[model samples]
Target chain A: MRPKIYLFGDSITEASFDDGGWGASLAHHFSRSVDVVLRGYSGYNTRWALHVLERVFPAVDSGGEGVGDGVVPLAVTVFFGANDACLPDRCSAFQHVPLHEYKQNLLAIVSFLKKRWPTTLVLLITPPPIDEEGRLQYPYVENPLGLPERTNEAAGAYAGACVAVAGECGIPVVDLWTKMQQFPNWEKAYLRDGLHLTQIGNKIVFEEVVTSLREKGLSLEILPVDLPLISEIDPNDPLKDFQK
Target chain B: MRPKIYLFGDSITEASFDDGGWGASLAHHFSRSVDVVLRGYSGYNTRWALHVLERVFPAVDSGGEGVGDGVVPLAVTVFFGANDACLPDRCSAFQHVPLHEYKQNLLAIVSFLKKRWPTTLVLLITPPPIDEEGRLQYPYVENPLGLPERTNEAAGAYAGACVAVAGECGIPVVDLWTKMQQFPNWEKAYLRDGLHLTQIGNKIVFEEVVTSLREKGLSLEILPVDLPLISEIDPNDPLKDFQK
Candidate 1:
């Protein structure tokens, strides 16, 4: 079976296959090497994601006869906290989880995945810095009160919590919140509408994710291509190359 | 488990997850609904592809206890014939298969898939129209003799055979050969390297595939989204909606 990489997150990850999405870039980068599987759920907070964890990655039988839920993934990225950071008093409060609960939920997720695929690499990605002005201009839904449902400050708290959880778990973390802020005019450059990523923003996430995997010895340079390259096949004895 | 759509073909299909690939578009289109799996073999022709088919789609046990190789896909696309269309007397002769063999191989593939997944929607895609001039300009390998390894005429034959095979099997076939030539400046517009696709070419394939699937009762409109939409969840009791 091909080694698989799972992207588990919310809307940000869910829309990662769009024209220039980070997920699509990952799929392209890992083409013929690792299969990238998206398990993103739009509008999901860490609390809601935690509720669906087991169903998404169900436990296999002790004997492993059934090979339940397909193969164990090589790595899984937990990229929630976007919706979790929504302002509790705003229109998007329904998707909000308390700051403390968000961190705890992420911890639970990492633990569950570790138990399921003991050796699988676990990576966490903090929510990107929000653009309050952009959010006001492009709300996902009708904002009758005309207030942004999320703020960069509120999202930073979730991002910090995500980093803290990653540190506690001894795994890698991609602090998108901090990374995006490092760029000048990031409000319009990295984000398309204050929350979701722009193409360039997607590229950054893709690079960060790849770098994280590379540091752990999963670089494309080392990963074997699935089949022999066309140039490798001898014209006279082609079948010989297809031998198992 | 999410429904899967498998793309089985040669290099053109292999590179379908590239920056502006049809496979990426498909994945984006089917987001939150079906999973698109790529099983493309670069530099592989029908003969070579047939040799590896069984291994790629291994048979499951009668009782189906293990889901031997995961869930059955909802649809599978058999896209080949590009490399097979290479001119027999040219440098790419090594990858060539006789026209008759190409048709027979496709028939066998369709038979095998139907037996394995009786209800699975099977779609065939013909090789796109080639540009002999473009082939010489952007040769994949060194061409000291300054000769094109593939020809538009040969590709048309292979595409015709592909369509015939699909007709014999009673499955839908994307006549990319004919469809591409219908464009006024197709030589440069559709094909990037005479053989592979340009962004617009990929978009065309994406649309054709979606249309074919739609005709067979698999349109995105009818396919239920995997989970509850955020709007559908009651803010007062979100968990109540996730009970399933």
Candidate 2:
């Protein structure tokens, strides 16, 4: 059974495999090694995520020996809060969830994964910092929402909430919110819009994710060396390795 | 359960999910409705594929009564012939397969999938035309192979064979070989190297793949309307839709 890396999140998570996407980088880096399952839900926040998470990732239903007991994935990345951090009681009113509820929802997700798919590693990524000024200059994809529907400060707060939850849950977290800002001229540099990641932003997350997963034993150096190379096997008996 | 579309092929297939990839395009187009599984094996020809195919996509073993009989995917795109059509008499002899054998391998793949995964539609994509001029300018990824290990004529022949096989099997085929060349200035515009696709090439494949799948009844217009929306469910009873 091939290993799978599940990416769960909102639009940023949704667009993780876009052109020059972080998810694409991961897929390329781990080509022939792992399957990167895209579970990105566009326009979703913690509240909606909480409701749909179970269907997307059902628990091991029957422990007493059943097909549902397929091997747990190698890792699951929960990347929410981008939409959740949209200023509650502000424009684009539908997607926003209060900061406290976002924290609680994240905790529930991490805790559920821990209890159900115990073997898989869970990593949380805080929403990247938003650019209110930059956003006002550009029309975000969710065009109906007014400019500055989300603010860096508000997103930063949710990012902090994410960190607190990750800290309490003992999970690895890629603080895109903080890391993206560490670079020079982050406002115009990292974000594609005030919301999504640019190529640079995606690469940062990709590198951090690979590094984090490697630390958790999913090494980048460990290519699928175990699989039989074509030339290594007799051309006439190609199926031998597979059959065994 | 989400419907899945499987992409199976060689290095080109392997890189299909890369940034701005056709695979990513498919994923984006089918977002929230379907999952696109990347089953790309690099430097592999149809002969190697024949042997390893079952392992990657095993037949529904003991369908009589078993959980292993999970839902078959909506479609599977078998894209080979790039490496298979390697000029056997010319350079880098490792990946070369005789024309007759190449045809046989294609037949075997289709027949096997038709019988094994009966429910899933299998679409065959002829490898894109090779650009000898571009290839000479740029050393192809398979560097051991000569500057022109493959040729447009050679690839086209295999593509014809592929079309013939598809016709005989009565299955859908994406004649990329014929379709790509239909445009003027095809080579410099589409192919990055003689063997692989550039951004334009990738987009063409993405569009063709989507169009063909839709023609086979998997329409792009259809959203996953069957699944319950978050708003439809009570926030306190998140698992309601999932359990049902």
Top-TM-score structure, candidate number: 1
Model 2, range B1-244, lDDT digits (tens) per residue? 6677889998788888787889878887776688787888876889878877767775445462211335577889999998888776555456788889999999999988787667779999998898898877776334553557778999899999999999999999999999999999899888887778888889999999988988888875764642454456444454464566
CA displacement after TM-score superposition, residue A167 of candidate 1 (Å) = 0.4
DockQ of all candidates, in order? 0.63, 0.44
- TM-score of chain B taken alone, candidate 1: 0.95
List chain B TM-scores, each candidate: 0.95, 0.87
Instruction: Give the number of the best model, judged by lDDT.
Output: 1
True contacts kept of 2: 0.47
| TM-score (chain A only) of candidate 1 | 0.95
| Maximum-DockQ candidate | 1
Model 2 regions more than 4 Å off: A64-69, A138-147, A223-226, A229-244, B60-69, B140-147, B223-244
- Residue B115's lDDT within candidate 1 is 82
Off by over 4 Å in 1: A61-67, B61-68
lDDT of each: 0.87, 0.80
